[model samples]
Target: MPPSDLDLLLRLRLVVARVGESDNANWWASDGVLSPTGQYAYDRIAPRTGPFARARVAFAVAQERCASQVPPGALTLWTLPADTEEAFDDRWSHWLDHVEDWAPTFAAVEAINTSSILTALVEHGLIDGQHADAARALTAAPPDPSVRLAETAHIDVDAVRQLAAGFACSQPAALVVPYVRSNA
Candidate 1:
């Protein structure tokens, strides 16, 4: 059976949470919520502006995806750090308004992940055989978080190689090409 949208997002979150693991391995919890470490990592990556900028972009996409799917007002309702429900609602709505500013960043994340990580997963044997079609389908554009997930989620090969390259000079820089295929 195909994976559910939440399943795919869960997988994506897992893969991304491990990025730069010497510093970010435990960035997220199993439930996909951001831990303190995750929040720090997000803060670190969010301001980056250069090559390999997907770290922060990914966080925004994942955050937005997660927030958009849950029951309306649930985050504010249950996550109130405020003394009053009214205050909680007001703060949460303000946060949502702030999140809207991340739309462009989220779009960039979708583009890079579709072009880079999605293809890299296949090239590195993280995706293969029957699952390739579903992975390929994702390259067209960022699907709704409600997209039917592939049974097997793709791997984060870029992180693997970066770890390897830390130990071996022979690791090729070209291993993780960030190019988008014209047909994708």
Candidate 2:
């Protein structure tokens, strides 16, 4: 059976989030300096060789889906707190609440986020050795996912690039509507 349209939307959103977070180019793009195609726009300026072929394809599909469906806006980043106990606790609680809300409709994304946070905790040495092991052991299974992955059609790379180029244009600080293209 084919995936539903909503499934495609969710997957595309997830991919956009991942690529946006990973690449600084996407960060700037989200700031409206370029198209919200994230890594696709970044690769346009600075190409790199990689074993990330599959991931790249996934991101491109996500970018295209988003360009077609979701409107561009401000960029939001998920961050781990500083090493301070208060900060850590606050951040953790905030994320826990977010996951609880997300789990009901986006269990796969929630699971991915949970795993990412756990890995960050261990990697940053916030929890070490036995504590890390214990945390890992006590991890709960992700709730039933509302969406599943399926193959998507390939997006036209050149068209996305052209759109990104248009997005990179900017106006003077006080100007609105008519954009004076920045010499980037």
Candidate 3:
């Protein structure tokens, strides 16, 4: 039997999330501007818990997953607090709520965000400008990804240099189009 389309789609999303998360963690670590764990984005969400203590833990977990070349083992440890069992819900988000109310969502929505972030990294030179090869390894792009991988995956990779280029232009920002639910 063969796996369904949904399975393939999910696998792609997983790859994207892992790569993106890894990049974000690395970026946060050596940006040279942060005072340990201080991220300007999260300040509005919550107060600091004695500086780098909390932020270090978060990046460590993310980087550990990257180092293993797979999702981290035993995320179940990301559970609710209270020194009791019933205080928790069996979901990642719930566990995060226990840890910090803001939680820093990076679920499947990450799939949509990865392309732009990678593009940014390439543009900013955080990662090597060998962006095209990295993109090819991660995607089965059109004009036959397998053949492209064979012919140009390793060279100067100029042909596929436009890697994931379409996505940045085609995918729109996540917009919340308002809808009126009828009052009558």
RMSD of 3: 17.2
Q: lDDT per residue, candidate 3, 94-122, as tens digits?
A: 33444443233222222223435455435
Model 1 weakest lDDT span, ten residues long: 175-184
* TM-scores for candidates 1 onward, in order: 0.24, 0.19, 0.25
Best by TM-score: 3
Model 2, 1-184: lDDT tens digits are: 1223223323333433332332322321223112234235554664442112223344444344333322232111111112222343344344444444433333232223221333433333333454434323332123311111111232222211122222212111210110111121
- Candidate 1 collision pairs: none
Worst 10 residues of 2 by lDDT: 173-182
All models: lDDT? 0.30, 0.28, 0.29
Q: For residue 62, what is the lDDT in candidate 2?
A: 32
lDDT (10s digit) by residue, model 1, range 1-184: 1223222332333343332122222212222123334344454766333212333344454345334533343221112122332443344343344555544433332232221333433443434444444334432122222222222122223322222121111111111111111111
Cα error of candidate 3 at position 68, Å: 7.1
Top candidate when judged by lDDT against the true structure: 1
